[model samples]
Target: MRDAPLEFVTAMAAHGDVTRHDADGEPVYMLHRPDLARHVLKENGAAYTKDRTPDDDMLRPLLGNGLLTSNGAEWAAQRRMCAPAFRPAEVDRFDRVIVEAAEHLVAHWDGGRPVRVDHDLTSLTLTVIVKAMLGTDIGVAGEGFGRAVDAVNRFIGHYVPSDDPDPADTAARYAGFHRARTFLDRVTRVIIAARRAGGAGDDLLGAMLAEGHTMSDADLRDQVLTIIMAGHETTAKSLTWTLYLLDRNPEAARAVHAEIDEVLEGRSPTAADLPRLRRCRQAVQEAMRLYPPVWLISRRGTADDVLDGYDVPAGSLVCVSPWVLHRDPRYWAEPDAYRPERFDPDRAARLLSHQYLPFGGGPRICVGRHFALVEATLVLAVILRGLRMELVAGFPVEPEALVTLRPRHGLMMIPRPR
Candidate 1:
């Protein structure tokens, strides 16, 4: 199980478009083929739901019935209520906050010292998310929050096992998971309570309070916790992998820095600058293709369905692995190579539709997609503007599959003055 699951999935993908595996004698289908994924994600999405028992059971206590783990009417209601907050205008409002956080992060980096890029990116992204979404001083809350997140990941890693659960292990896992959740919940509740007492003071949380969409304290708690847990780690992991790829491929890194230099010059990046940061965005896209933090998106069929000549019974578990599909030779050329140019507009147009599932697809696609792109591009621009990085000698950056894909060993790199 220590072996990277993406590697196994990619190898299997080379043999067939889709493959089936048995987990604890329960049949599960892995959809690595792009067309098949599209069929399930796009065409037949409504017939399926994001309701998987093991995942839901594991995450439910932490996320509650929030959008990431909720299903049916509950999901629809929350999605409708929360969708406005991620609109173009609202997301654009986050630009300055994101840049400010990035600037603060850059100010603290010791350029001459070897640093764990993954840890740095995670800290930076978490700060941005907290400021932009919650309007909280996460720099103050960051240490405890980071520890809780790490504990949650460690708990999930141990808990997601195939063997029949041991009572002791089960009890320990529950304790760890709930402890993390309780810590996050305390942070979330304090914010919510402040908002209720009219102290939110002109931020997303304040806006959410004004809307009054979440009437129940339980609902608000779940939504706030969901965003904090779901948004921060995924975006951080994406940036970590992007930097890792760039460090190994200097040519691509050079192109990215050049694009940033030419496009934004000394000015901080904004939503308007996103179009000019096309190369930067492409590099991040390619990185996500290679290492999508949400590598495998699992769903369950609500009814019997036939997909690409395979019968999928109702209640069947279907996993669509972007890590495999993104590297399929049928859709990509030299799939293993780091080539951001493939995503250039003219070149990208030639690729098959639905070939890329970096953020999944269809109605259930990531709502924070635009927000993430803007944040990552802005942060990348800020980081490149003042610093250059080199991979640390002989540091093995292996992939660790957890709730998200992270470096098995932290990403250590040498940063130098630009």
Candidate 2:
């Protein structure tokens, strides 16, 4: 019973699985055991669904039964319709879009001044996702969307069940959520309308429309909103975290640059160069293990189940946190160290299933995994080729547990000319 909240949860994880009584006094199981987490996420995945808490409801207005939050038949249908859009070939098609965005970001960097790396990464990814997914220019809409995301992150970070009603606070939270949703809704609707008007061309939205599914305005908005939010935030954090790690680990950063230099020789990275950027990909993978974006994944059991000798009732809230599992000593050697060699193809090939769940597992695993990896790798290569970053003195980087793991204070760093 510590006074702090998230620290208590993090400490509880070091031991075996811990169950806490929620606001309703119902037991919510937090599985810190890596093997058990693997069992539930991969081996026994069929027993769980993603609708674990009111968080889904909070996002429902904007996502509107989209694949990310939808369960059962709706999830299946959305997955089927959008699966092709994220296929390896389709994701490769967005390489130029990602490279272009990276170049645009690099062009704005001032080597003379300290820059907030977090903001730059977010803006870059948002621009790339908007162009690649919808074939639309959301440059004007990005500022509002970024603010809304900040508001949403703040809301999720400080979330606690209310024991007594405070009307002003409640109204403000709801207002913030709605404002964020409205911003995304406007962008999504415009993209959908443009696609319908034959402007999407060869982008993902165009492919979705060509599939012959007559989605209503609301449904289309939700799907687009979900993709845009997830597409930008997750990969942006991945790159941000990678940069943080690189600043501290110069040798690892050098290895990555060497790989890129040998592979591309200063040309922009294309899909074919992705495989050649092995060290860069490993660096990103290791960074994710150290600072995963989607740190905690929650689910609710649809039926009673026993996982690793613990009884989980039909309505139990089950959380399998990658933040804990990725660093489990039983699975990783030198768990706290930043070592990209762990993900080397030869090494990773021998790992047990579910040992590394950066993108999750099972049927409901993130459909955007390929997309995120491509975007992260390309951005990493592009940045390293042009500039070098060093951690700023006296600027503390602390992980803030929100819907994703972001820096509490902005990630400030100094960019020196390479």
Candidate 3:
């Protein structure tokens, strides 16, 4: 499971929609059917808690008790506090930030050389989140924050829970983790201090800061870090995979380019144009279906329950994986193929509940879903209209199932100006 998580999960899904396995003497239940997902993520979501899950164990060290790690009333309050800023109208105001960031990346690309676009997109997204949500330019802090996240991702990428571990390797990994954590902590404090002095604005960070009387500086820091990690990292990987999939399927690429050409007509897209950029939207949606950024959603059952006739005992590790669910033949046609039309608005609306959850389902659905889709669509339009990325031959692309599913080797591609 540690070395090849995708294969392991895929094999498990093949056995049955609901399968039970033993992991170090603990029960791990995998649910693949859509109704089962609905049952676990929605109907009985209260009975399941993120506490003690792998995600909680790995991220709580860095994310603290932010939305991702908190439970019960705390989580609800954080969600309510953070909700206003991500409302569709509020997110629409960030469109300029998203477009400008993408335009900056397009202007910087050297058409003559191969670029590691995955890395570049990561930086671009960091800039967007910092400027749009945090209410400040990334400036000097952006580079260090990017490095810190990369180091943290590297550490988490190789992490596997264990009773006994190698002392030397564990020490090395924790050394880097602590270094990253320290840098993140320092930068977060500086941002909070600077933002507080200026008074809170209307962005996500500002929204949180507006309620500062109720939250400690440490609490604010945790939420800020959570937004940074959840906001930027996941969107960056989604864009990277969207481009990779387009490169893999020329027909889809041509369709996307045609739609962009028709929709923009040589002008940069605005938030208003989002609804009209159907193909661009569909392509991103399809790409996520194939390689969701948050591939696995894990929780621990707080009480015993029967899901689809399978008994899930309290203290068991329950899994709802988009990676497995998206490909289930029960919900998708040609599940292995890259077909963007599967998300054509009419067809998309008909998809069964919980069958296509790139942003997840239930009350815990990503608060930034609208923000991410708008950013992804506009940025994708910008890239497809301005340049063409060709995968460098023999550059092996495999999904590394870490905290986020990322291309194992950074996506190496040659850019040709459109």
lDDT of 3 by residue, 1-418 (tens): 8878889999999889899888878889999889888988899999999999988977898999999899999999999988887889988888888998899888888555899988889989999988888988868778788889988988876645674367788788889999999999998888889999998987888888878889998999999989889989999999999999999999999999999999899898899999899899889899999999989998899999998887777989999889999888878889999999998878988999999888989888999999899999999999989788899999999988888989988899888887
Measured by C-alpha RMSD in angstroms, how accurate is candidate 2? 2.3
Model 1: CA > 4 A from native:
1-4, 158-174, 199-203, 211-214
Model 2 stretches with alpha carbons more than 4 Å out: 1-6, 17-23, 54-58, 164-170, 211-213
lDDT (10s digit) by residue, model 1, range 145-204: 887888788676543455535778777877987888788889889878866885645655
Whole-structure CA lDDT of model 2 = 0.80
Q: Against the true structure, whose TM-score is highest?
A: 3
| RMSD, candidate 3, Å | 1.3
Q: Give the local distance difference test score of model 3.
A: 0.89
lDDT (0 to 1) per candidate = 0.79, 0.80, 0.89
Error of 3 at 400 (Å): 0.4
Q: For candidate 2, lDDT tens digit of each residue in 333-365?
A: 999899998988999998876667788777878
